[model samples]
Target: MIITESLDNKPAAVTLEPLPDGTTWLYLRKNAKQVEADTGDETPDAKPWQCETAIGKLGADRSGETADTINAKFDDWWTYAAAWAEDEPMPTVQEQINAIYDTLAVMMGV
Candidate 1:
């Protein structure tokens, strides 16, 4: 993963994947929750481990660091993300980040 600043001057996560020719490309994956349906016949059940958020990935990036090492350390990351999503009274930096991405995508053909 390579962290770089967007045109909006915000640090964003860029995941790099290698191609067969030994080249790589970047994809922006902001912190958020991802859910997928479970597959089982007859009986219905949600996947137990599928309810995870992006904290694990963040945690990996912050390995060997204490809780106090970071500012936006998820103490209220969920609420912040939600408020930003709905455009409430106060939005988190992550929400602002989405807007930046939208603008960049349109202007820069991302």
Candidate 2:
């Protein structure tokens, strides 16, 4: 699968394929030209590999010496992103009780 999306306002592409056992393989290719100085260029010769592991589990960050390394970076970012997204306080005990009571009331047509 070729995912063409803009990240950080730059065009990015991610290619993913599935292994025989339902594992996904991901590849990040630099499809656009860049100044060599600014390039964290992924070696185009790198082959796709299964997306698993702490970093590889999400196929997010694609810059690293190896597939595993790249995925590891992604895992780090994902952890932060997930936590940031859910940065809310837990419900209080009374709030939880109220929710249960609300559900019970609906169940009893109250």
All models: lDDT?
A: 0.39, 0.43
The numbered model that scores best in lDDT is: 2
TM-score of each: 0.22, 0.28
Question: What lDDT would candidate 1 get against the real structure?
Answer: 0.39
TM-score of candidate 1 relative to the true fold:
0.22
Measured on C-alpha atoms, candidate 2 has an lDDT of 0.43
Count of clashes, each model = 0, 2
Candidate closest to the true structure, highest TM-score: 2
Clashing pairs in 1: none
Local lDDT at 75 for model 2:
46
Local error of candidate 2 at residue 11 (angstroms): 37
Model 2: residue 23 alpha-carbon error in angstroms: 23
Candidate 1 per-residue C-alpha lDDT over 80-103 given as tens digits, one digit per residue, 9 for 90 to 100:
322332123546899999999999
